[model samples]
Target: MLKKLEAQPHPDDANPLLRLTNLDVTFTTSTGTVTAVREANLTIYPGQTVAIVGESGSGKSTTAAAIIGLLPGTGKVTSGSIEFDGADITHLSPKEWVAIRGSGIGMVPQDPMTNLNPVWRIGTQVKEALKANNVVPKSEIGQRVADVLEEAGLPDAERRAKQYPHEFSGGMRQRALIGIGMAANPKLLIADEPTSALDVTVQRRILDHLQVLTEEKGTAVLFITHDLGLAAERAEQLVVMHRGRVVESGPALEILQHPQHPYTKRLVSAAPSLASQRIEVAHEKGIAVTDEELTGSGAGSVSTSEIIRVENLVKEFDVRGAKGEAKILRAVDDVSFGVRSGTTLALVGESGSGKSTVANMVLNLIDPTSGKVFFKGEDLSTLNSKDLFKMRRKLQVVFQNPYGSLDPMYSIFRVVEEPLRVHNIGSKKERVNKVVDLLDRVALPRSVMRRYPNELSGGQRQRVAIARALALDPEVVVLDEAVSALDVLVQNQILLLLNDLQADLGLTYLFITHDLAVVRLIADDVVVMEKGKIVEAAPSDQLFDDPQKEYTRELIDAVPGRKIQLAL
Candidate 1:
């Protein structure tokens, strides 16, 4: 259980723009009742940037939803009052909420993948928001849409405006949603995980834009995020939540430097952005963690084998032009790289840069337009169906979105055991035993075996996916943004788990990610890609210390909290 912070009094002269007093939120589910937010109190002064930081299911989003009066099914604020602009608004009808939603309080939702409508074009969606909120005249809505999209960091805004949500990549879709939310520039803007899907450079640009809005327009911003470094860097004030309660709330830098709560200390220590400089802190405390432990294979195992190799990989797609002329679009342009046995090779790039395409080709899920993939010195294309099926046991993949990757209907136990049962590896009892062991390896409790994916947090669901991937004891695991959706502490734990698994099982890893801060922690070798081409390749240390390419330097510089150093 998380201990609560000591009660503090609010100053009478400091008039906050938004204040919640003794807020208690509860939900009525089919099984029973659940308290999402218990006696939560928070305040945001005018034009001040405040962040609610927590892991998934910690009630950060619930508080935001309560403020917006948009709680999902059977959720309600049971007690206390929410005062906004000196008006008590604890219980408002749906009709009254409609008035405050768009013009008064703008919201950037959490999930970009499912937030936007699939049928509508991006520009149409933005224009609709503008028209509804009356942010701009109807005659100027078209130009305003383009302006907002460009401001949100989407290149070629005019062309992208016509594209549907499905046509854009995940990061692009997120930028579109951001454009919609910031279109009106409301007095109180609630941004929930706004930069979670963006690359480092784009994320920096977006956050900077928000800061400018706060400075110039007096837009009191409420940011909801799981990133500790981002919260510390972007917000002036911070509120840390754990298990549906606010554990700490104070100045961001003070909380980060001298954490009063145990949870806050864990967040500061486990954060990769801050952990980069805490090597000595780990040692002074008698901690044994070293950069070498994060690397794959022992010193001698590096000379033993090369598991996966890609030579001059090229992938192209033929798109018909407006005049029916064929145009060839090069997705992966003659990229060459190799993953040594029991080591991690990270493919880092922006969205739609062919990272996922390259991973798919390596997994043999999609055939490359050209080039060859050799697994254990065996060419993948030469294999017949039987050989391919046999080779599959040697290769596996864990995707980014755990909720999307997992089947909602299946229990955790069934999800892990299915792979074993399909392979016909053992009896039913043996499969059950294998699942229990896999869960243990992933640090998940046995009680979670009966729970469904929908009932678990993002981190818990990812653990279940990891357990399933290890069920086959594969030699290579392609982790594509596996921990991107988790909080800092959870991401740290997952990286450590991967390192340990590689040491014990001799597993080779092909890691695909956009976060360079994460790459610095877990990757042994880094291959930087731009426009589907390899621009830089070096060891993690060399690349971070002195990046060769201009693009690589920009990516490193854009990492949040590059200036601040954390200490105990």
Candidate 2:
């Protein structure tokens, strides 16, 4: 940045909005002082989408957190000037932050579970948010909540408000968050990876809401996320940060087209979210790459003699819903899928489309209501305790949030060794060696062996989870959105690692994720689910080139830059 910075205000920039100058976030740890953000400077015009992009440790999320006064208790802005609508707000106290947070500035967090009160009704949450800053009167807050919820593109807002967070879907919860944020008509919205976990369909709607807000309401948005394609497609300006420093800043198009920074370039090429329509079309044209991948280098690694095979799967959950008594909700109805030796058949869908249910049935974590699950061509549902214990070694699952899955009390090595011990795979010393090798395979430093889960970053914790999952050397690994919580570069590295493991050990993968990029990159065959049924199933290239299902087509079209035709 120049000494004076680009001081040129657009001629009509008289209402020039929020600006941050010489911002630095620091923390006083027991060991020493850590500077998380170093002299970061940025400005957002009145009606622009100014995106701050970077990896996990890049300070992007932290910067947004600081702005909204929601940073960790240990963190504080050491030096900076935060000018909001021509007023300096950096020195504001906790109470002042509370007042300004909702009324003048709004923030949408990445995880809904964090911000949402599980016990509270959706309507009550929205009402409380509106009442917090006294933006709407107590008497009128209810109506305002419904209005804003609908404005956030939620249907049946009245009905939804009465329901709890668990009653609503993932997409609905996000919309509720947006509705709460917009309840006060905040001048600047700070969204931290607003749709990072949403499927392509829901992601489109979320971005559309954000885009329309800026266009119609002139809401100056400080969009913060690691999704570069999303930024390029929707943001007007882009700010690239790396290792807590600003590496590049310019127009979104220019930056995406010609990224001057190598880090930015790596992120750009690491994972392409753009759906390959041509691949689907070609596959429909009889071109086949999915089957080739289905039987490639990893094909023979899985014990073909037997692991999981589902035939005519039907799963029903007894949900004590609105119908008075317990009701049988068809979570998985007549769904058939298989995980053969060393092959991946990815399951993709919006949340509540029964993907998780399918995974559970496969794992025998939950029994199917009616159908039979065959493991090694035998009935898994009828397995005895000892048989189940033996089968655990052959099957493993990697959950979405690694930190949640891990035991904070255990060190990295101990965490990895638990599975080995549980399976009695080796002696104590052998288990240690296996843990070290697993860490290496996941690209995690063995030095982290002594560290706890909380000591590691999000990416590192996820790596630990992957390492733990591979500890048993299982023939099948069921990854449930394993890489969704990570940044693009790290996500790519994990995908590559998965590929390498499959190639080396011939492990089978039942990859369950909503990310089209991951599916495109690693999946052999694609299974698109809608309302508990497979709507589209074909080889990856073929499905992308020519989607037979309307839902699949909509999903491809929902990708941010898919239609723009970027130069690869």
Candidate 3:
């Protein structure tokens, strides 16, 4: 029998900072009214950090939206009360909400691309937060913006502030959002998946800053995330929501260590940190396994042959300096790696570490400054335009952002069949059959084919992207941060789907991501990159068990909930 642990007591238990009592939120759509949250109850004392964890569409974000008074598209609190700092705030006027924002409560939303204004400069946006809150005088807004950006972990803050949202990477834009949210030093901060887009090292830095705010300023935080490992590591209280209801709530470590609810148990089991080491090593301990043993292939295996090879690859770009002078930026510097014909090789690194640049060089999407990429012993650069066009059929890529990659105007059927039509491989009827088969392989229903990309969820859209990538039967596929944005269950499904496809079709993968926990599950070998250079390379198990480089150790250490021991 599992033991039922009691909730941990807090010093400020007598005076709650934020409390949601029997809350119910609903959204009235064209069809009907749908309850997004039901009877949800939770409490956070002064300086307390509470995390709400669930799969996508489990009402975690809805609850946060209700608290912040930003419920979208006819969403409203139909019942219950939201008390903040001992005052009822369930229904505030527009002017009242404006006053409450920034100074009273700040928000860091999930999607940086949508939340940050594209037309405004990064520094100008940060200054708006300061000015709106009246935290500083107009004369001091410039320096305050720089300070906030630097504190949020962006280097060369002044220069970065001048750049637009398009100029910043996904991680940098997320950091800017964090800086804007924390600029006013509000009493309550709502961070909705704040660090989901960041690398582990930078994520640690951002969370550490939040910790400082909680400790020194007594700032309460309502954290919303899909990553249970991260929630356990950072939050004091944990609330589990499933199907628009709170399934479990209690102390963070205790609930995760010995979960009672079935949904919570499933989340605990699906977490990459707890379920690492999915790949089987079919050999004696400490003995290296053969290629055949690693991939479970027989005599027909292509593991011995190198399908893709990058030699001394270098890529450079021209950019403007802080002083408006032209400067050369070496994105990938003398990096080299090889992908075996029937294996998975993951490139793990932080943003701006040149992983994607290397992938681009291998895919022939961009020309390298120097060095060579060989496919089946043929140099890519030497190929003519016609040859390059034909080679694309043999090499395919699935980008990070599926919503951006997939055409919103095209139906799912057309999106998957586009590759076949472009390659002139089959007739219309034959292409339709191929699209259906591909969707089946990815575990998506045939009904989705009639719908468009906008109709599907994040996971469904990614599945559609994979189906398209596999339409041409490519021997090598480059998955660039493919599963980074998905929730755990969806990410696990995609990884398993990739593994099954690789086994069935003898596919090779060049997987690029910053997530080491997922790497442990799917990657056969690992290449660690730092600032456009390869710092370490080894088999997955060897690297995880005994990492040689200091940077590698730091990255592994940064994986949340790795050190926590959970009960079976």
Query: Evaluated with lDDT, which candidate comes out highest?
Result: 3
Using all chains and alpha carbons, the TM-scores for the candidates as numbered come to 0.88, 0.87, 0.88
Backbone clash pairs for candidate 3 read none
Candidate 1 structure quality by residue, lDDT tens digits, 1-568? 1112222234779788899998999999899999999889999877678889998788999999999899999999999889987888789888888777777778888778789989999999999888888888878888999998987779999999999999987667877887787788777889999888788887887677666654666778899988887888777788999988999999887888899999988888777766653532454476765654333321123434678989999998877662344477789999998887888888999886788899999999989999999998999999999999889988998999998999998999999998888788999888888889999999999899999999988888888999999999999999999988888888878888888898888788899999887787777788999999999998776687679999999988777766555564
Q: What is the C-alpha RMSD of each candidate to the true structure, in Å?
A: 4.8, 5.0, 4.6
- Candidate 2 lDDT over 1-568, as tens digits, reads 0011122246663655788898999878999889999888888877667889888889988888777777796898999777888888887888888878887888888888778999999999998887787876778877888898898888888888899998777888999998888778888888888888788888887878767754577677887888787776777688999988888998876776677889887876664563233233334466543432222222123334435677888887777544644577888878876665677778998888898899988888988888888877888878899989888878899999987999989988889899888777888888888888888888888899999999998778888887888887788999999888887777767777778888888788888987676676677677888888888887765686678888898877776555443443
Question: Could you tell me the lDDT of residue 436 within candidate 3?
Answer: 90
Q: What digit string (tens of lDDT, one per residue) describes model 3 on residues 195-285?
A: 8878888787678776775456677888998889888877878999999999999898888878999999878867775555222222224
Model 1 stretches with alpha carbons more than 4 Å out: 1-14, 121-124, 134-164, 167-172, 277-304, 320-326, 409-411, 445-452
Q: Which lDDT value does model 2 have at 44?
A: 80
Question: Each candidate's lDDT (Cα)?
Answer: 0.83, 0.78, 0.85
- Compared with the true structure, model 1 gives a TM-score of 0.88
